[model samples]
Target: MITLKDVCFQYSADSTVKALRHIDLTIQDGECVVLTGESGCGKTTLTRCLNGLVPSFYEGELTGGLLLDEKNLLEMPQYEISRHVGTVFQDPRSQFFTVDSTDEVAFGCENLSMSTEKINQNIQKAFHNLRIEALKDCSLFALSSGERQKLAVAAIYAMDTPVLVLDEPSANLDLETMEVLRGILQELKREGKTIIVSEHRLSYLMGVADRYVYIQDGEIKQIWTPRQAEELSKAERKALGLRSFQSISLADIAKEGAPAEQGKRIEGRGLAVRLDKTEVFRGLTFNFQWGPAGKVVGITGNNGSGKTTFAKMLCGLLKPSEGALLFDGKPAAAKERLRQTYFVMQDTDYQLFTESVRHELELAERKNHRPCDMELILERMGLSQAAERHPLSLSGGQKQRVTIAAAMASGSDILVLDEPTSGLDGRNMQRLKETILALKKQGKLIFVVTHDMEFLDGIYDEVMSFAQKIR
Candidate 1:
C-alpha cells in the first residue's frame, strides 16, 4: 500500500548531515511493521517522510521518490498525503489543539467536510472501538496518559486513513494498558489497516510484529521477519540495537513479598484548591508518610485530575488556594519547602537551562547549597558517558536522568518528579528504578507522578489517586 524508493532526506540546508539515506521499504495492507533504531537514528524522520512532512513541515533536502499507491508522496501536498496516511505523534499533547475528547476526535473528520452526522458516528465508533466510550465527554486535559494515547489513536482511526503510523505508542503506558493497546492493534490488523509503529519496547511488540526494520546511522541496517527476530540471541539483539525487557520487580530486588505501610510524611488537613469560581479539588485531604525511611511514593490519577497541580502544591510551586501544607507535622512555606523539596517538571527542557550535563547539576548544587559530587550521581544514572555533552543533544532517557541527577544532587529531603519515565525503555527504566531506590535508601522522600506502574511496583509505599470532584 506504501513504498519508499531510494529515499534520502536532510533536516538542514547543509545537506551533508543526512537524516535518512537511500531508504527502500514497502508496507502492504494489514501488515504490522515495526521500526527499530537508537535515538536520532532517523526512525522518526523516515516515518515523517511517509506523510510528506520531510520537505513540508521539516526543512530538508529530499532526493528519490516515495509512492503511496500510484502517486508520489514527495510531490503531493501535505494535506492530500495526510488523507491517505494518518500519523499519531510520540507526544499526544502535541496533537491536541481541541478542548473536549469528542471535539478532538471529530475535528479531523469535520475538516475533511464529512457530514455532521457522519462525523458524530465516526466519533462514537472510534470511541467504542478503542473501549474509551466513557471518555467521550471528558475534557482533553482531564484524560490520563493512557486515555490520551487511546484517544489519539481513536482520532487517527476516525479519519479512516488506509495507512496509520504511530511513534512509540507504548512509551508512557503501564504494562496493563500496553496489552490493551496491543489488542487494539491486532483488531486493526484484522480490519486490514496498514500499521507502522516506531517503538523501543520490543518486548511488547515481540510476537505482534510481522516485520522488523532496523535503522542505524540514517540507513536501513536489517529487515527481518518475526521468525528471524525470534531467532536472534540477546547479545545479537543488542548488537542490532534492540532494547531488552525486564520482568524483574522491586519485590524481587528487596526480597520482600510486600511493601511496608506508609504512615505520614506530608499531611494536608482539609486542603482544597480553587481557580476563580471553579474548584479543582475540595475538602481533599491526604497524608504521605515514609513506609520505610527509604521508599518511593507513586502518585497517579486521570490526567488533569490535578496530578501536576498537586505536585506543584506539594513542592510549593503552587499554593493550595485554601489549606495548610504540613511537613512532618509542622507548617511549611517556601523557605521550608525549598530546604526539603525539589520538583522535576514533566518536561525536562522546562527545567534544563545549562550548557552541559555536568554544569546543569553544578548549578542545582550551587542554588541549593548542596555538595557538588555530581560525578557520583551521573555514574549512578549511567550518564557519565554523556556528562560533557550538551544537555539538549542527549536522548530522552539520558536527559531525564540528567534532570533526576540534578534533583538528587540538590540535597533536598523530598523530591517530586512528574512523569519521569514517560519516554524511557525497559533497560533505562530499570536504571531509573535503581537510582530512585538509591535515593530512597538515603532517607530522601521520592514522590513520582507517572503512569509507569511497572517501575512503581514495590517502590511506592502509598498510591494516591484523584478523581474530579463534582459540585
Candidate 2:
C-alpha cells in the first residue's frame, strides 16, 4: 500500500509556483489509479514526488508524509526507492541509456546486481509479456517514438517491481499500440501490482483503470470509482476540463460541411525522396489545394512511412531526390518555399528559442517581416496569462501552444504542425481546433502530421495517407 498525508512541495522557497499542496491519497495493492487534470495543474509533479525524483534530483522544498508499503519514502534514498517503484517517463528517449533494445531492457536488472541467469530470464519474460520479440536487436536510436515507448515499458517490466508509475504513456503512440498498452496494464493488474498513471488521454484507460483522481490548482478536487466515472456525462466532463472516458471514432465526430472551392494549388510530379541509401517514397503524384478557404490536410501513416519526411520536403527543409513542386501553377524554388513555410516541430523545445511567449512572437515577426497583433493572438490561444512566463518554464502542452501561436503570427502561407495535440486535454484540443479553423479562414495552408484520430476527425477537412512501404 502507498499513502500520502498532507503532502506539499515547491520548486523554490521564493517561487510562486506551488507545484503541489495538502495532498492526501492512498492506493492499495493491485489498484490502478489514474491522475487527470489540465496542463500544469501538478499531475506530473505529484508523480515525481511518488517516484522520489522530487527532492532527490530536482532542487525543491518538500513537506509531506509519503509512505510506500508502510515505509516512509521521504527518508529513503532515490536509488533504494527506485527498486520498489519503477517509473516510465513521458518521453522514452530521455530514460534510455543503452544503444540496443535488449540491453536497455536489461539495464535495470543489472543495476540491482541480479544474477546473470535471473537477468536473462527477466528479459525474456518482459519481451514475451510485451509481445515485442521483433524489437530485441533493433537500435534504440533507429526505433520510432512509439517503438521506443514500448522499450521503455519493457525495461521497467524487467525490473519486476511491485509498483509502477507511467506518465503519459500513450501520448506518442498510434491506436494499435495504445490497445497493446491497455492490455499490458490489465495483465499487470491481475498480477497484484500497484499502477498509477498520469495522463491527459483518458479514453484508453476507461477499461483498465479502477479509480480516477482529478487534481486542480495543486489540490485534489475529485476522486471517483470506476462505476462513478462511467456515469459522467460528456458535458460534465467538458465542464471539468477532462477528456472523454468513452471511446469515440473519427467518423462519429467528422465535420459534415463541404470543402471550400477557392484556394491556392500545390502540385507534385514524380515525387521521390531518399535519405542516404534508404528510399522513403517514390513515384508520388498529387495536387493539394489550400488557402484561406481551404481544408486542413491530415497526413498519417505507420511509423517510418515518411509522413514527417514528406512534410519536411514540402516545407523546403529537405530537397526531394526527384520531383517538381508547383505553387499556384508556377514552379516554386526551395528558397521561395522556405520563405513561405512555417513548421511547428514534434518537439516544441527545439523551435522555441525566445525567453518569453510574447517575445517569441516578436522574433517570429521579425524573421517574416509580417505585422501581427501579438496580444490578440495570445488571447485566442488561451495563453494571454503566460505572456511573461519563460517558454521553458511552461508545461509541455503550453510550450506546444506557444509554438503554434508563433507560427500563426509569422504570416506564413504554409504551416505544418507535427503532433500538435500530443499532450493536450479535451478542452485544449477544442481551443486548437478553433485556432486551425480561424487560420483556414485567413487562407493559410495547414498540414497536420499526427496519429491522433480524434484530433484529425474534429478539425481536418482532407486526409492524405502515405501507405507506401519504405525500402
Candidate 3:
C-alpha cells in the first residue's frame, strides 16, 4: 500500500509557486488509480512524488509523510525506491539512454546486476507482451514518437517492479495502438500490480481503472469509483475539463459529406524524401484542395508512416529529393512556401523561442507586418492570464496553445499543426477546434497532423491517410 499524509511540495525553497499542496491520499495493494485534472493542476507532480523524483531528482522543498508499507519513502534514497516503483515519463525521449531497443530494455536489469540469461528472458517477455518483437534491433532515434513511448514502457516492464507509474502514456499513440495499450494495462492488473496513471485521455482507462482522483491547483478536489464515473453525463465531464469516459470510434466520428474535390489545389507529384540515407517516402503523389475560404484537412496514420515528413515538405522546412510542388497553378519555391506557410511542431518546446506568451505572438506578428490584437489572441488561446509567464514554465498543453497562437499571428495563408491536440483536455480541444474554424473562415488553408479521433471528427473537412509502404 501507498500513503501520503499532508504532503506539500515546491520546486525551490524561495519560490512562491507550489507544485503540490496538502495532498492526502492512499492506495490499497493491487489497486489501479487514475489521476485526472486540467493541465498544470499537479497530476504530473503527484506522480513524481510517488516515484521519489520530486525531491530527489527535482531538488524540491517537500514536507509531510510519504510511506510505502512500513518504509518511509521520504527518507529513502532514489535508487532504493526504484526497486519497488518503475516510472514511465511523459516524454519518452527524456528517459532513453540507449541507441537500440534491445539494449534499452536490458539497461535496468544490467544496473541491478541481474544474470545475463535472466536479462535476455525478461527482454523477450517484455517485447512479446507489448507486441513489438520486430522493433528489437530498431534504432531509437529512428522510431516514431508512439513507438518510442511503447519502448519506454517495455523497458520499465522488464524491471518487474511491484508498482508502475505512467504519465500520459497514451498521448502519442494512435487508435489501434491505444487498444494494445489497454490490453497491456489489463494484463498488469491481472498480475496484481499497483498502478497509478496521470493522464488527460480518460476513455481508455475506464475499463481498467478501479478508481478516479481529480486534482485542481495542487489540491485533491474529488474522488470517484468506476460506478460513479459512469454515472456522469457528457456535459458534466466537459464542464470539469475531463475527456470522455467512454471510448470513441474513428468511423463513428467521421463527417457525413464526401470530401470536396473542387478547390485551390496544392499538388505534389513524384515526391520522394530521403533523410540521412534512410528513405522515408518515395513516389508519393497527392493533391490537397482548399476552397475559396478554407478547409480543415486531417493527416492520419500509424507512427513512422511519414506524416511529419510530408508536413515538413509542405511547409518548406525540408526539401524533397525528387518531385515538384505546385501551389495553385504555379510552381512553389522554397522561399515562397516558407513565406506563406507556418508549421507548428509536434514538440511545442522546439518551436517556442520567446520568453513570454505575449511576446511570442507579438514577434510573429512583427515578422509579417500584420499586427494582430495580442490581447484578443491570448484570450482566445486561454493564455491571457499567463501572458507574462515564461513559456518554458507552462504546462505541455499550454505551450502547445502558445505555439498555435503564434502561428495564427504569423499572417500565413497556409498553416500546418503537428499533433496540436496531443496534451489538451476536452474543453481546450473544443477551443482549438473553434480556433481552427475561425482561421478557415479567414481564407487560411489548414492542415492538422494528428492521431486524435475526437478532434478530427469535430473539425476536419477531409481525411488523408499514409501507409507504411509507399506505392
Tens-place lDDT per residue, model 1, 1-471, is 788889988776435467888999988878999988765578878888887778887787889878888787777887788788898987788888798988899988887788988898889889887777778777765565567887888899898887889998876655555767788788788888899998877667765679989888789989989888777887786566566544332334343323544654688887787655446776768776665466577776554466776787888776777778898788999667766788987766788898898988888887668685777888887788778878876555567888888997888878999988766654566677788888888787788987555667656666676645221
> Which of the numbered candidates is closest to the native, going by highest lDDT?
3
Tens digits of per-residue lDDT for model 3, 1-471: 999999999886326578888999999889999999888888988998999988888787899999998789988888888889999998888889989989999998887778999999999999999888878888887787788888999999999889999999998887777888899899998999999999888888878999999998899999999999889898888888888877776677876754665778898999998877689888888777777678888898887788998899998888999989999878898887888889998878788788788889988887578878888889998999889888987888888899999998998889999999878888888889999999999877899998888778778887788847321
By TM-score, the better pick of 2 and 3 is 3
Location of the lowest summed lDDT over 10 successive residues in candidate 3:
462-471
Q: Taking the tens digit of each residue's C-alpha lDDT, what string does model 2 give over 317-362?
A: 8899998988988988888788889988876778889879999999
Candidate 1: RMSD to truth = 4.4
Q: How big is the positional error of residue 311 in model 3, measured in Å on the Cα after superposition? A: 0.9
lDDT of 3 at 30: 90
Per-model RMSD to reference: 4.4, 2.3, 2.0
Query: Could you arrange the candidates by lDDT from highest to lowest?
Result: 3, 2, 1
**Clash list (residue pairs), candidate 3:** none
What lDDT does candidate 3 reach at residue 309? Answer: 86
lDDT accuracy of residue 194 in candidate 1 = 90
